[model samples]
Target chain A: MRRLWIGLTYAVFALLIVVPLVKIATGSLEDGVSGLLDALLRPEALHALMMTGIIVVFVTLINTVFGVMLAIYLVRAAWLHPRIKGLLNSIVDLPYAVSPVIGGLMIVLLVGPDTALGALLEGAGIKIVYALPGMVIATLFVTFPLMVREVMPVLQEIGSQQEEAATMLGAYSWYTFWKVTWPSIRWGVIYGVVLTVARTLGEFGAVLVVSGNIMNLTQTATTLVYQDVENFNVVAANGVALVLAAFSVGLLLLMEWAKKRKEVH
Target chain B: MHIEVKGLSKSFGDFKAVQDVSFGIKKGHLIGLLGPSGGGKTSILRMLAGLEAPTAGDILFHGKRVNDLPPQERGIGFVFQNYALFKHMTVFENVAFGLKVKKLPKDAIRERVQSLIELTGLKGFEHRYPAQLSGGQRQRVAFARALAPEPQLLLLDEPFAAIDAKIRSELRTWLKEMIERVGITSIFVTHDQDEAIEVADEIMIISKGRLEQKGTPWEIYKNPETQFVAEFIGESTTVDNVAALHGFEEAAAWTGTRGLIRPEYIEIGKPGEITLASATMRGVVRHIHFRGSEWMVELEIGDIRLITYRSLEKDVLKPGDPVDILIHRAYLFNESDSWIMENKLKVDPMPVII
Candidate 1:
């Protein structure tokens, strides 16, 4: 009975996820291979690819640096009160709960031209809202929690014992981190980075609202797919959508490979 | 190097784990900090290792103060009770960790690691991770790691507690021999009196976060300063109204109470006039346990119960047999019941006139 239940659950999961992918593949194949390739390699499609890649790279880099530091601080620092720690931890998790569009709106409200900081920046000829910087901010906000969540549990499990041991063996704090702490969590950090990249690449709602879907500049692959589909350019939209899907799948595969390697090691 | 711990104290919130612990360890001696769990032996060792700071007082190593130094800078080696080896590192790398951290050349590190591996009998297992080793092997690895740095002092915190009972005895012997070979001043913590006796040059018995007694193992076993230490160190039988016994007049005068006797010193079926005066009750044998060369007999002396050891070849007494017991060489105490004095042996040592 248990095996039957498991099989049924897996069958349902495969149907839910794989059927649409199979349909998309068949529809893309209905067009000739050269036509599909031409549609995918169009200048507008290349612009969308470049824009999404830039956003993902920006978000992933910022998240990795800040997330690792945040995780280390949360685990090692005692100056922060427990309530403050909880508040900060929950704030990191806010992006997951808030809708991506809502996240974009929050960023706009805080950094838009009307706000004090936004006005100050705007006075210096630095445009943020409805621009590349705004899109980066939105993507960062939506993907901020991934790296922290992945790295924090691993750090907590490794605990302070190894660090203390390293220190006792004459390694200073920085040396101990470099020698002992970093090696233990490197795989988990890599896994988190992959997830963050995948999320940032696929992000559309927040990026669309923040960047105003500016063609050839701010329009990401996801946003361009939305535009193509809306304009009834189904083949071009599907081709770009396939590339986005393929990149996300590649990232997922990378994450799973890292996870398996960690388990085996 | 000699270590002098002066009035060291540590408290965790409201509970004082170690209080006013002051002791000096002479150079080139293996000292055992003996205590039951929660008796602050580990805390004292931690303070010595500079893993923890005393809430009060200071520590001096070789007459130089080092209370504020970090563990690595203290030039002290520490072996944790769990043998905290790095799970990912092989035995050779684990031992070489300290050398590498010291920024030694690669060839020097390799030579030192190889020497330590050979010394620890881990030559064949040098490439094996800690997870792949047994508890005793892991303990040896921890010892090697601590010793590779060639620190002036070494601290072992219950090093053999995690090993199997059979291996623990062998490890204790090996550890004592190893410490003697290296001749580095060492301190090991243990609750097992037998382990302390077998390994330590001097044993410091602690109770309730305070030092109860500090002496050689023989002195601790034969002349415990407190009832807690006496009971903790070995098997002892308390005699009620011991003041009435022979040679106990001065003891009775001081204590106004009874005294205790170790089981090994007690003899059955014999008593002198004054010794008879202390013989308050006759006992019936409850059971007899043959222990290799000696027999341990449990006796029911009226409502009280006592155990005494006799030679295996002595007259065998069964359950319900009546017997007379005497306190041959007993320890006397003061009014506080703290050990005041001990009865001296009367026999002279045989002369070796070669």
Candidate 2:
């Protein structure tokens, strides 16, 4: 009876997830391997992929440092009033609910060429909207909450006792954090980084709105796929989608591995 | 090093946790901070370890004011109740952490850590992480890690509270011996009287964030200075308005004071004859409980209930038996709750005054 129940659950899971994934993979590979390869190595496609990589790298670096700091402050800052702390906690979850297109629009309104701040930034010789900076900013806004949410619960669970113990052992505050607090929260950090990278790689709406999808200049892989489909080049569009699907699968596996490592430690 | 705390008080918003508590510790003496939970024992320990800043007061290490120093500069060791061993590091790495921070020579650090590992009876377990060790072994690792830095003073917060009951007693003795060997001035907090009495050379009792008494274990147990200390240290019973309870209206001056009595001081005897009995009252035996080698006899007179411990070698007393109660000595406390020595140790015979 248990085996039958298990088999039934597995069949439902396969039907819901595995079937759609298989369909996407096969549809993307309808063209020959060389044809897919030809489309991937094209300068436009390569540039778009590299642009996505640059954005993911910069977003991961900035958000990892700032996200972890925000989490620590939220959990450890004793002087913060409970109401304010609770409000900040709710704010971290805001990006998850706000639409990516709305987030890009909000950034544009704040830093668009017409706004005073945008004029100031432009006067300083920096372009924000319809540029690389705008794309990076929009990507950052979308994935900012991932790392903080991942790390906050783990930081809360481990508590401050270990850090206090480190101080009592004649360790400086910085040393205590690096030696004691870091080890406990490192896995959460790795998990958060993985999720951030995955989300950045696939972000389309916000980056599309901000980048203006200007061919090879600011167009990312997702934007390129959209452009290809618009030009009625189905095989080229499918090629980029296939690569993204592959990367997402790799991230899922990485997440699984990280979860196991966290359990062992 | 000897330590001194003057007017130490810590307040959190509207609540005061430690209130003007002052005390001193001689070098190499292991003291126990005994109190009920939420009694500020932990707050005092944290302040001494420089983990918690005092709201108002000064802390001195060997006559040098260390109130403004950070925890690392204070050079103190702390053992948490849960042992707080680094979950990720091996035992050897945990012990070597402080040495590494101090930038000790690599060889010297290795030698010191190896010896401490052996000293703590964790020789073979050096490679194992804290999660792999038992609770007792984890406690030893925490101790060894704290001692590796050769701290001037050590503070432990209920070191044995999390251990199993069977192992708690064994660990208590082992911990006492370990502290003696290390020769560091140490203070540990506990609510268990037996643990405090067994492990500490001196016991400081606190309640509701106020220091009640500081004395040797024998002194605190036999001669507690306040009503709270008297009952907290051991089994004790207190009678409010002793004059009314004993029906001695002539002794109305003792109206507001409470008479503190020890269980062992009261005895049961035949009703008619009074011999060597300073105070006598009549009560019926309500219950008899067997406690190890002694039988605790519970008796009730009017609205007051008293528990008396009798040796198992004596004849057993059953329930509902009428008996005369004898109290050899007792303590008297005034309305302000201070001990009134003048009215102590005396109980006049009833003389059918009622």
Candidate 3:
């Protein structure tokens, strides 16, 4: 009976997930090599892929640094009251609870031309909404919690004993953090960065709202695929989707490796 | 260097962990900070290591105030209870960490680390990570790492609390030998009285964040100044119980004061010779248990009871056997936790008053 139940679950998973992925893979190559090349090699699609790549890299870098700092503060700052610490801990996971569309709308409200923050930046000739800056911010807003959540647990588990030991051994605060604390949590940081990258690559709703889906200026790969499907260009859409799936698979492997490394420690 | 702590106190919010604790550690002595759990021994050790800032008072090292110095600047080696060796580094690297941070020459760091490892008996385990070592080996690594910087003073917080029972005593002896070889002034905290008595050159007993007493092991055991110390340092019973059993009304006046008598001082006498010649009070053996090479006999005199230790080779005394016990010696303390006088009385069945 247990085997039958497990088989039924696998069948459902296969029908819902594996079947569509297989169909997309086969359908993308339906037009043969040249046709597939033509779809992916189009100037607009190439530009869109490059835009997506740039935004993902920028978001991953910014979020990784900020996420690690936030996690360390949450774990190590002794002066924070319990209530305030709990509030901040919950807010770190705000991105996970809030929808991406709402996250994008939040950025739009803060940086659109009509708002004070947006008008002031515009006067300085800094473009946010409908540009690369706005797209990166939107993606970051949705993926901010991934890295912090991953690193915070590891930091909490390792505790401050080793750090204190280093300080007692004539190590300053910076040296202690670098030599003792960082080594213990590096795998967690790597895992978090990869998760953020994976999430940024697939981000659509927030980027769509903030980037305005500008054809050549801020049209990321996801928006490009959406636009292609709207125009009944199924071949182009499938090609882009297949490339994203491959990147996601690579990211999944990296995340798995990171998790394994953490367990060994 | 000799160290002196004057009026040191630490408070967390509203709770005072260490309050007005003052004591001096002489140069080149292995001192034990003995206390019960939550007795603030660790807090005092942390203050000495500069890991904790006392809420008030001064900490002096060789007459130089170090209250404002950070832990790294204090030049003290601190070993934590859990043997917090760097998990990511090998034993060699862990020991060399401080020297490397100081930017010592490569050869100097290597030579210092190798010697310290050998001193701590971790010579062959230099390449092993902390996780790969046994509990005792890990403690050795922690000790080696703490000593690598050639610190002025060494502080350890319950270093043997994590070791297995079978190896704990061996490690304690080894640790004492190692510290003597290093010849640095050191302080370690422990809750185990036996470990403190066995390993410490001088013991400072603390309770409720206050220093109860400080003296050599024999001094502290034989001449405990406070009621807390007398009860905490060794196995003993109150003198009031002995006085009450013998109907000494004057001795009852010492109640709410201090008086202690050790179990080993009292001995079993023949019940048939019940005269006042050699027995203070007569009682029946209530219980008996073989304790190592000795028999722990409990005696009941009316409603009062006393415990005594006798050699197992002595004639076996069974429960319900009436026996007379002789009171050998007892110490009395005043309200200030100071010894008032020693009352050495000859055992006699009389209403003897002190």
**Model 1 DockQ vs. reference:** 0.47
> Which model, 1 or 3, shows the larger DockQ?
3
Q: Among these predicted structures, which one has the highest DockQ?
A: 3
**Model 2, TM vs. native:** 0.93
Q: What is the lDDT of residue B168 in candidate 1?
A: 92
**Per-residue lDDT of B146 in model 2:** 92
Q: Between candidates 2 and 3, which one is better according to TM-score? A: 3
| Deviation (Å) of B158 in candidate 3 | 0.3
Interface RMSD of 2: 0.9
lDDT of 3 by residue, A92-116 (tens): 8898899999999999999998899
Model 3 per-residue lDDT at A25: 85
Chain A alone, TM-score per model: 0.93, 0.93, 0.97
Q: Which TM-score does chain B of candidate 3 obtain?
A: 0.92
Relative to the true structure, candidate 1 reaches a TM of 0.87
DockQ category of candidate 3: high
